[model samples]
Target: MAIPTPGQPVRGSRSGAPIMALFDLLGRRWGMGILWHLSQGPCSFRELQQRCETISPTILNRRLKELREALFIERCDKGYCLTPLGSDLQKLLVPLGAFSRTWAEVLPHEEASS
Candidate 1:
């Protein structure tokens, strides 16, 4: 079966916004984890499974298919790795990781006061 791609209809929004399509895909179970691990370097399916511990083979397979269809990653002799587009995505996510650390530190205090 063909995998879904951005610019197509997606859940939670009918506008067909590219961002919504992206979010819908990434928000799936272990989707982000797959990207994060691939950001470092190429990895075989087994290696990916080890890095993303607790992910069942079924879900991992599904996410890989989705990522490939999105042009975010590709499979090569070395293993599965990010495409140039995916590497660019990793660059974009770097700042978010920094922000997350800051948010993480502040969130506990805010929650305690609530």
Candidate 2:
């Protein structure tokens, strides 16, 4: 979770934060990657790190903190899992991720491989 400063809210209602706030909160360095990895299932911090291809401890920690405060995730005995809102977000992202993958497959990188 983001380190909530005194006199500042950790997060506000969806209407309260702007689109940029949502993007800025989750699109920060390694932020989406953390969420994407966790989307599969809850995993320990170390497991999450490994799944994220060894994102630096500092950045991973920061993203986790931000995600927590945003109410997009929760920590459990198993590890971190998406909140109800977050699961909704994940559902939304699935198509985006599919598009990204298919788009990339059409790029020169794939052409070069084949």
Candidate 3:
């Protein structure tokens, strides 16, 4: 499948914001997880499947197709790895991971509500 063009509608947004389109794509199940695992390095299908222990082949193939369409990943002789654009994206995710760790630490201390 081809990546949705900028003017095309996606998920809940017809506004055609590029960011919204990206979120719509990445919001799919295991989307971010797949990217996270790929960040470690290129991986064969079996290796990636092992990393994402719970994902089914059907979903993994589907996500790979979509991500390729979006130019975020590619299959090489060794296996699948991030494209340069995707590597840049991985860099951006580093700060988000830091924030997530901070949030997780604070979550345990936050007051519970009835």
Candidate 4:
């Protein structure tokens, strides 16, 4: 794949706002975790918080609301779940997970003395 030349924009992107916009939205607090949690199935906010394990309720609520507005997530009888686009985003996270596992495996760790 060719890298975008310096000072030149990539195809179809004007100033990279579109891509940055997605990250700006999702890079906030629980945004990515919310997407990850919803991948299993629809769930309520409480459950979502539990799964994330670290997100504060306030932050989680904010991210979920933002995602819902972006049409990446939805709320229903199930409480919260990914919208169709959100489902697609879930598929995208798979490779990142694999990369993380591979990276952890190659890193050095402390040895326990016998």
Best by lDDT: 3
Candidate 4's displacement at residue 104, Å, is 0.5
lDDT of each: 0.85, 0.76, 0.86, 0.76
What is residue 31's positional error in candidate 2, in angstroms? 1.2
The root-mean-square deviation over C-alpha atoms between each candidate and the true structure, in angstroms, is: 3.5, 4.9, 3.4, 7.0
lDDT of 4 by residue, 1-114 (tens): 133322335444556456655665666666787898789888888988889988899878777767777788888898988888989988998899999999888988656957
Please report, as a residue range, the 10-residue window in candidate 3 with the lowest summed lDDT: 1-10
Q: Pick the candidate with the highest TM-score.
A: 3
TM-score of 2: 0.77
Model 1, total clashes: 0
Q: Write the per-residue lDDT of candidate 1 for residues 1-114, one digit (tens) a residue.
A: 334455667775576677878788888988788999888789899999999989999999999999998899999887899999988887887888899999999885655564
Candidate 2: list runs displaced more than 4 Å.
1-17, 110-114
How do the candidates rank by TM-score, highest first? 3, 1, 4, 2
Predicted structure 4, TM vs. truth: 0.79
Question: For candidate 2, lDDT tens digit of each residue in 1-114?
Answer: 444332343354334446546765765778777778889998898989899986998988778877888788999998888899888887877898889999998876834464
Q: What is the lDDT of candidate 4?
A: 0.76
* Ten contiguous residues minimizing lDDT sum, candidate 2: 1-10
lDDT of 3 by residue, 67-91 (tens): 8888999999878999999888878
lDDT of 2: 0.76
